[model samples]
Target chain A: MAEVMEKTALFEFLCRMGDNTLILGHRVSEWCGHAPVLEEDIALANTALDLIGQTQLWLEYAAEVEGKGRSADDLAFLRDVWDFRNVLMLELPNGDFGQTLMRQFLFDAWQVVMLGHLVRSSDTRVSEIAEKASKEVAYHLDRSRGTVIGLGDGTEESNARMQAALERLWPYVGEMFASDETDAAMLAAGVAPDPASLRAEFDAIVLPALAEATLTVPEGDFAHKGGRDGGMHTEHLGHILCTMQWLQRAYPGAKW
Target chain B: MVASVEQVWDWLDAVPDPEIPVISLVDLGIIRNVAWAGDTLQVTVTPTYSGCPATSIINLDIETALRDHGVEKIELKRQLSPAWTTDWLSDKGREKLEEYGIAPPQPAGGPERCPHCGSTAVEKLSQFGSTPCKAQWRCTECLEPFDYFKCI
Candidate 1:
C-alpha cells in the first residue's frame, strides 16, 4: 500500500504544478490587451503562452501515470474548485501591474530553483519536463526581476505600490516552501526536491533582487496553506474556472 | 521495401517550418534523431518553445511527409532532454533566416543587427514578434523594420 500511496503523492505533486501554471497563465492572459504598454501586452501574453504550454505537458503526463484515458484537456477543464491543487498565491486577483509582477517574481524565483533540483529527478520523465520548462521559467524570472527593479525604484507612487504588493504577496511565498507528507514521499522516492531544503536558495535568489528594488520582504510568520492536497482555495479560483472551463464544458468536446 | 533512416532524414529536410517557410525544419535543428526499429521508423523532434503553436503542425507535417514516402510504421517522439535552443540552429539556417529578412539569432544577450543593411544600429520595438520565436526590431541605418529570432 505504501507504493500506492507514493504513486498518489506523485500524482498530487504533478497536479499542484499543473494547476499552478494553468491558473497563473489564465490570470496573465487577462492582460493580453490591457497592459500599460504595447510591448508589455505582448510580453505578458508570451509568458502566458509558455506557462499554458507547460501546464498541458504536466497534466497530460499526470493522466498517463494515473492509467486513466483522460487527456490534459479533461483534467484542466473538467475539474471543480475542490479538485484543484494549485497554491493560493496563484489564484489571487491581479490588483495591478505591480502586484502581478510581485507575484510572478516570487513564484518564478521559487520555480527556477525548484526546477533546477527537479531536473535531477530519478523519474526521467519528470526530469525531462523540468529540463524543458526551466529554460522558459528563467526568461520569466528575468522579465519579472527587471520590472520589479524598475518599478520599485522608479518613482514615489510606483515604489509605494510595489512595496504594498510585496507585503501582500509575501505571505504566499511561505506556502511554496512548506513541506508536508506528500512532499516527503516525493522527496524520499527521488521524484522531487524537498521544498524545505530549497528555502535558503529561494531566499538567496529573491532577497538581493528585493534589496535592489528597494522593496521590503514581509516579516510576518502567518502563512495560508492546503492547496497542495487540494483541500483549500481562494475565492478567485472559482470565477477563473467558470470562465476558463465554459467553452469546454458547454461544448462537451470542443475543438478549434 | 522498408525506408532507411537516412532516406527519412532526406524527406524531412524538405519539410519547411510552417511559420517561417524559408528554413526547413532539419536546418532549424528541430529534428533531433531518426532511427529504425524493425519495420518501424521513428523520428524525434524538439519544440523551439514549450508553448510554440507550431509544434503540433510540425508533428503532423512530419507524419504526412513520411507517410507519403511509403513508410508503413512510423513513430514520432517528442524529446525535451537537452532542450532545444537557438544555438542548435545550423549555419545554413542562420543564412536562410537573414536572407528571408529576419535577423538570425545572435549569442544570448548579444546585440541585434539589421538583416536589411547589416547594420548593428537597431532598436527593439517589441519583445514579441509575428510569432513567439521572433522579436520586432527596427534598424536605424536602413530605417527598415525587421524580425529578430530571439536567442533562446
Candidate 2:
C-alpha cells in the first residue's frame, strides 16, 4: 500500500476506535438511575464513565489528527446517524441487567485483548492512551465478568435470558476482528493490532467463563456485518443522540 | 506590616474549579496549607482523587490565581500520602453543594445521606458519578439522583 493510503487507514481506524467508546458511553449513561437495582446500577454507570473518559483522549487525538475544526463533541453530537462509525454490536439496546452484564463481559474481554495488543503499537499516541485506559478497563472487565456469572448461573429465568442474549449478540461478534483495509494498514504500521491475531485470545478468555456460567456458546460462521465504515445503526442510537446532544444543540459553545 | 495567613487565605478564595465551575478549591478543601518559606510562598494542595480529569487544570488554575495575587516564586506541592478525604469539606461548602443540587461528602463518619433531599434512606446507584470524584446516589424521598463527593 502507498504511504498516503497507510496514513489514511491509521487515521480511520483510530476514529473508529474512538467513536465506538463515545457512542457506547452515551448509550450506557442512559441507565444512570433507571437501573433495576442500585448496586448493579452503580457498576454499570461506573463502567460507562471509564469508557467515556478513555474515549475523550482518543477522540481529542483523532480530531487533532483529522486536522478539521470539528471537536470531539462536534463529531459525537453534530453527526447524523449515518455519519457515526461505531460497531453495530455496541448499538444494541440495554436488554436487561443480565443482558447488559453479558454484553459488557463480552466487550470487555475483547477490549482486554485489543488493548493488550494495542499497548505494543508503534503509534505512540494511541498506545499511550490505551496503556492508561488499560488499567481502568481491567477493573471494568472483572466487574462485568462477575455479574455475568452471577446472573447466568444464578437462576432459571436469568440463565434463560443470559442464553438468549448471548445468542442474539453472537452473530455480530465476528465483525469485531474482521480486519478491513484500514485495519490492515494500521496493523502493518503497528498503530493498531492485526485483529487477525487477537481472535484466539479473545475466544480463550470468553469461552471458559461462558462454560463456567453453564452458558452455551453459539455456533455457525454466519456473521452479521455493518458499522466498519458507518453504513447503518440500531434504532436506539437515535434516542441516544436526542438526549446526549440536547444541551449542545440548545446552546452552541456555551459552557454549562 | 506583615501579611497574615488569613490575608493570604482571602487572596486564594477566587480559585474555582475549572471544570465544575461552582466550587472553589477552598470550598472543596483541596487547598491544604498556604505558608511562606522565605520570600517563596509554598502552597500545599491535594486533588479530590487520583486520576481525576480536573487535577491538571486545577493545579494550573491555583498557580495562575495566586500569581495574579502578586505571590512570587510559588511552589505547588501535592500531598498524596494522607490522600484527600471528603472530611476536609467546609460547612459552607456543604451548604453550597446542597443548594447547587449536588450533595456534599458525608460528614467524616458513617451514613452518607442524599444531597437532593436530606434522607439517609438513599442508595448508591453507581461507584462512578459525573466524575471519578463522585459516586452516583438517589434519594427515596426526592427520587433525584445526585453526585456524592466521594470520601478519599
Candidate 3:
C-alpha cells in the first residue's frame, strides 16, 4: 500500500514537471511567424521546440513510473484540463511579445533553480533528466534575462509594458512555491526539494535580473493557488487543450 | 559473422550529421558507446538538445548506415546521463565547421573570428539560429552572416 502511494506521488510529481513544459511550450509556439521581427520569431520557435522536447522526456518518465501502460503522447493529448498539473501561469494567454517574454523570464528563473537542486535527486532518472535539462534551461534564462533587461530599460512605452506584464504575472508566481502533500512525499523520498525551499534561490536569480531591468518586483505575496495540486485551473487551459488535442481527439489514433 | 566494434566506429564515422552535413556523427561526439551483446549489436547515442528536431533523424541515419554496412541485429540506446556538451566536439569537426562558413563554438560565449573572412570582428545577430544547436552571428569585416555552434 505504501509502495503504491509512493508511486502515485511520483507520477503526480512528474506530471507537474511535464505539464508545465507542454503548456508553456504550446503558448510559446503560438508566437511563431507572428513575432514582431524575424529573429524574435525564430527565437520563440526554437524556445518552444526545446520546451516541447523536454516535455517528452519528462512525460515519458512519468508514464513509466505510473505503470499505467500510457505513453507520453496519451498523457499529453488525451488528458482533460482538470487532469493537468501545470501551474496556472503557464496556461494563461500570451498577452503580447513583452508579456510572453516576461512570463518566460519568471518561469526560467524558477526552473533554473529547481533543476539545479533536482540534479542532486536521489532518483537517478530524475537526476539524469535534470542534468540534461539544466544546460538548456541555462541558455533560456540567459536569453530571457537579457531580453527583459533590454526591453524594460529601453523606452518609456517599453518600460510601461514590461512593468505591466510583471504586475499581471506576479500573483501567479506564488503558486509555483506553494507546497503540499506531494512535495512532502518527494522531500521524504529524497526525490526532489520542497517547492517552498526553491523560493530563496529563485528570488536570488529573479530579483536581481528584474532590478537590472529597472522593473519593480511587485508588492505583496497574495498568491492564487490550486493549479499544481490539480484542484483548479484557469479557463484558458481547456482552450489550449482544445486546439492541442484536436487531431488526437478527432482521429482517435492519427499518425504521420 | 559479427563486425568488430572498431569497424562499426569506422562505418559510423562516414555517416554525416543530417543537419550540418559537413561533419560526421563521430565528429559531433554524440555516439557514446558501441558493443555486441551476444548476437545483437548495441549502439548508444546522446542527443545534443532534449528538444532538437534532428535527434530522430540522427538515430534513423545511424540505423540506416549500420544496416547498409550489413549489421542487421542492432539496438540503438538513448543515454541522457552526463548530458551532451559542445566541449566534446572534435577538433576536426571544428575545422570543418569553420571551412563550411560556420563559426565554431568558443569558450568566450561567442565566436572568436569570422569564418568568412577570418577577421576578429564579429557580432551576434540572435541567440538562436535555424536549428536548436546553433546561434546566428555575422562577420563585421565580410558583411556576411553565419551560424555558430552554441557552446552549451
Candidate 4:
C-alpha cells in the first residue's frame, strides 16, 4: 500500500511538470508567424518546440509510472482542461509580444531553478530527464532574461508595456511556489524539492533581471491557486485544447 | 557473415547527418553507443535538442543506412542521460561546419570569425536560427548571414 501511494504521488508530480510545459508550449507556438519581427517569430517557435519535446519525455514517464497502459499521446490529447495539472499563469492568453516575453521570463526563471534541484533527484529517471532538460532551460532563461531587460529599459513606451505585463503576471507567480501534499510526498521520498524551497533561488535569478530591466517586482503575494491541483483552470485552456486535440478527438486514432 | 563492431562503426561513419549533410552523424557526436546484442545491432542516439523535428528523420536515416549495409537486425535506442552537448562535436565536424559556410560554436557564446570571409567582425542576428540547434549570425565584413551551431 505504501509503495502504491508513492507511485501515485510520483505520477502526479510528473504530470505537473509535463502539463506546465505542454500548456506553455502550446501558448508559445501560437506566436509562430505572428511575432513582431522575423527573428522573434523563429525564436518563439523554437522555444515552443523545446517545451513540447520536454513534455513528451515527462508525460511518457508519467504514463509509465501510472502503469495504466496509457501512452503519452493519450495523456496529452485525450485529457480535458480539468485533468491538466499546469499552473494558472500558463493557460492565460498571450496579451501581447511584451506580455508573452514577460510570461516566458517569469516561467523560465522558475523552471531553470526547479530543474536544477531535480537534476540531483533520488529518482534516476527524474534526474536523467532533468539533466537533459536543464541545458535547454538554461538557454531559454538567458534569452528571456536579455529580452526582458532590453525592452524594459529601452524607451518610455516599451518600459511602460513591460511594467504592465509584470503586474498582470505577478499574482500567478505565487502559485508556482505554493506547497501541497504532493510536494510533501516528493520531499519525503527525496524524489524532488519542496516547491517553496525553490523561491530563494528563483528570486536570486529573477529579482535582479527585473531590476536590470527597470521593471517593478509588483506588490503583495496574493496567489490564485487550484490549477495545479486540477480543481480549476482559466477559460483559455479549453480553447487551447480544442484546437490542439481536434484531430485526435475527431478522428479517434488518427495518424500521419 | 557477422560484421565486426569496428566494421559497423566504419559503415555508420559514412552516414551523413540529415540536417547538416556536410557532416556525418558520428561527427555530430549523437551516436553514443553501438554493440551487438545477440543478433540485433543496438545503436544508441541522443538528440541535439529535445524537440528537434529532425530526430525522427535522423533515426530513419540511421536505420536505412544500416539496412543498406546488410545489417538486418538493427535497434535504435534514445538515451537522454549525460545529455548531448556542443562539446561532443568532433574537430572534423567543426571544420566541416565552417567550410560549409556555417560558423562553429564558440565558448565565448558567439562566433569567433565569419565562415564566409574569415573576418573577426561578426554580429548575432538572433539567438535562434532556422533549426533548433543553430542561431542566426552575420559577418560584418562580408555581410553574409550564416547559422551558428548554438552551444547547449
Candidate 5:
C-alpha cells in the first residue's frame, strides 16, 4: 500500500506543477495587449505562452502515465476548484510588472534547479520531459533575473515598487522548499530534488537577486505549507478552473 | 566522379522548420549533410536543441517530404553529442524568417540586429517569444516589434 500511495503522491505532485504553470500562464496572458510598452507586453505574453506550453507537455504526460484517460486538455479544463493541485503562490494576482517579475524570478530560480535534478529522474519519461524543459526554463530564468535587477535599479519609482512587490511575495516563498516523505524518497530515488540540497542553492541565487533589487527578504518565522501533497488553496483557483474547464465540460467531444 | 550535391540540397530545401514554418531546415542549418549510399538517400540532421518539442516533428516532416519524392529510404540521425546551436542558420534563412515575422536565430556577437529594419539599435524585451525558438525584440527605427530567435 505504501508503494501505491507513493505513486499516487508522485502523480499529485506533478499535477501541482502542471497546474501552477497553466494558471500562471493564463494570468500573464491577460497582459498581452496592455503592457506599458509594446515590447514588454509581448515579452510577458511570450513567457505566458512558454509556461502554458510546458504545462501542456507535463500535464498530458502525467495524465497518460497515470492511466487516467484524460488528456492534458481534459485535466486542465475539466477539474473543479478543489481538484486543482497548484500552490497558492501561482494563483495570486498580477499586481504589476514588478509583481509578475517577482513571482517569476522566485519560481524560475527554484524550477531551474528542480529540473536540473529531475533530468536524472528514475522515471525516464519524467527525466526526458525535464531534460527538455530545463534548457527553456534556464533561458526563462535569465530574462526574469535581468528584468528584476534592471527594473529594481532602473529608476526611483521602479526601484521602490519592485521592493514592495518582493516584500509582498516573500512570505509564500518558503512553502516550495518544505519537503515531506514524498520528497525524501524521491530524492534518494533521484526522482526529485532534495529540498535540503535545493534550499541553500535557492537561497544563494535568490538572496543576491533581492540585494540587487534593493528588496528585503521577509523575516518571518512562519512558513506556509501543505499545497503539494494536496490540501487547501487560495480563493482564486475556483474561478480560474471554472473558466479553464468550461469548454471541456460544455462540449465533451470538442477538438482543438 | 560524384554527381553534383546541389540536387540533394534542393530536395532538402523543401523541408521547412516545423515551428517557424517558413524557412527550410536546410536554411535553418539543422540538416547537416545529405549523402547517397547505394540507392538510399541519407540525410543528416541535428536539433536546434536536444529537448526541443519541434525536433521530432521536423525529422518526420523531412522524411515525409523526401519520401513523397520517391527517395527510397531516409536515415535521419539526431546528432546531439556536440549539441545544437542557433549559429547554423543561413543568411537566406535569416531573411526568410524576418519576412515571415519571426526573427532568425541571433548570430553570436552580443545579440542579433532587429529583423524588422536591420537596425543594431534593437532591445530584448523578453527571453521567451510567441514560440520557443524566438525572443521578443523591438527595433528603434521601424518602431515595429518582432521576435528574435535567441542564440542557444
Candidate 6:
C-alpha cells in the first residue's frame, strides 16, 4: 500500500473503533436514572463515561491523522449514518436489564481479548491507549460476566429473559470479527492486531462463562456486516446522533 | 537565585487532585519525572487512565504551579509506557484518601477494606463510583457506605 493509503486506512480503523465506543456509550448513558438499582445506575454511568472518554481520545487521534483540521467533537457530533463504522450490535436498543447486560457482556468479552492484542501493537500511541483501556475493560468484563451469570441462573423469568437477549444479540457477534481492506492495512502496518485471530479467544473466554451460568449460545448463521466500510448502520444510530450532535449542530462551534 | 528542583517538587506537593481533592497530584503518583531540559523545566506525567478527564487539567495545574514559583519555560510531557497504577500512590496519599471516607486502593487482586470503622466486612456497592478511579462500597459492620479507589 502507498503511504497515503496506509494513513487513510489507519484513520478509518480508528474511526471504526471510536464510533463503536461512542455509540455504545450513548446507549449505556440512557440507563443513568432508570437502572433497577442505585448501585447499577452509578456503575452503568461510570462505564458510559469511560467509553465516552475513550471516544474523545480515539476520535481526536483519528482527526489528527486525517489532517483535515477536524477536532474530536467535529468527528463525533457531526458525522452521519453512512459515515459511522460501529458494529450493529452496539446500536441496538437496550431492551430490558437482561438485554442490556447481554449486549454489554457480549461486547466486553470480545473487547478484553481484542485489547490484549492491541496492547502489544507496533504503534506506540495505539499500544499506550490500549494499555490504559485494557485495565478498565478487564473490570468491565468481570462486572458484566458476573451479572450475566447471576441473571442466567437466578430464576426462571431471568433465565428466559437472558436466553432471548442472547439469541437477539448473537448475530451481531459475527460482524465484530469480519475484517476489511482497512483492517488488513492496519494489520500489515503492525498498528493493529489481526481481529480475525481474536474470534477464537473471544469464544473461549465467553463460552465457559455462559456454560457456568447455564445459558446457551444461540446458533446464528445470519451474521450482519458493513459498518467497517462506513457504508451502513442500524436505524437506532440516527436517533442517537440526532440527540448527541444537537448542541454542536445548532451552535456550529459550541463549547462548554 | 534559581529555584532548586526540590522547590518545584514542593510546589507540586501542594497541588491537590481535581477529582479527589484530598490527595496531591504528586502523592497520587501521576508525576513520573521533573528535570531541567535546556533552560526549561520539563515535567513528565502519566494519566491514571487514557481517558481520564483530569489529564489536561492536571497538566495545566502542573504548569501553573511551577510558574507561580517563578519558573519560566515549562514543558509537560505525557508518558504512558509504564501505565499508572494504584501502587504508585504514596503512603501519605493513601492515608489522606482513607481519612476522606474514600478507601485507598490495595494491591491488585487484594481484598478491600472499609475506610470507615476499619472493618474487613465490606461489600462493593458498585464497581464504579463518582469518579472513574473509585468504586462504591458499603461496610456490613458499620453500615457506612463509602468510595473505594479501585486499583487500576
TM-score of each: 0.96, 0.70, 0.99, 0.99, 0.79, 0.95
Q: Cα deviation of A101 in candidate 4 (Å)?
A: 0.4
lDDT of 2 by residue, A1-256 (tens): 5876876676578678877888777667778898887666666676777788767667777777777777776777777777677788888887877777787888888889998888878887777677767766776787678777877887999999999989988888887887777887787777887777788999998998898888999889676667767766777677777887888888877674
Prediction RMSDs, each to the true structure:
1.6, 7.9, 0.7, 0.8, 5.0, 1.7
Could you give candidate 6's per-residue lDDT for residues A1-256 as a string of tens digits?
Answer: 5999999988898898888889899999999999999889988988888888778778988999999999888899888889998999998899999999989999999888887888888888888778877888898999999999999999999999999999999988888898778888989999887787788899898999899889998775688776666667777888888888899889988778
Q: How do all the candidates rank in terms of DockQ, highest first?
A: 3, 4, 1, 6, 5, 2
Over A73-170, each residue of candidate 5 has an lDDT whose tens digit, in order, gives 77788777777767677887889988988899999998888887878778776786676567767877888998899888879999889988887778
Which residue runs of candidate 3 sit more than 4 Å off their true CA positions? none
TM-score of chain A of 3: 0.99
Candidate 3 residue lDDT tens string, A1-256: 9788889999999999999999999999999889999999999999999999999999999999988899999999999988999999999999999999999999999999999999999999999999999899999999999999999998999999999999999999999999999999999999999999889998998888899899998899999887898899999999999999999999999997
Report the poorest 10 consecutive residues by lDDT, candidate 6 chain B: B107-116
Q: Which of 1 and 6 is ahead in DockQ? A: 1
Name the docking class for model 1. Answer: medium
CA lDDT scores, all candidates in order: 0.89, 0.75, 0.94, 0.94, 0.75, 0.86
lDDT measured at residue B136 in model 3 versus the true structure, 0 to 100: 97
Model 6 chain A, poorest ten-residue lDDT window?
A226-235
DockQ of 5: 0.27
Clashing pairs in 3: none
Which candidate model has the greater lDDT, 4 or 6? Answer: 4
Flag regions of model 5 displaced more than 4 Å.
A1-6, B1-12, B18-22, B26-109, B112-131, B136-147
Give a tens-digit lDDT track for model 1, residues A50-140. 9999998899889887777888889999999999988899999999999998899998998999999999999998999999999889989
Winner of 5 and 6 under TM-score: 6
Model 2 chain B: which ten-residue window has the lowest total lDDT?
B106-115
The model with the greater DockQ, 1 or 4, is: 4
TM-score of 2: 0.70
**Model 6 off-target regions past 4 Å?**
B108-112
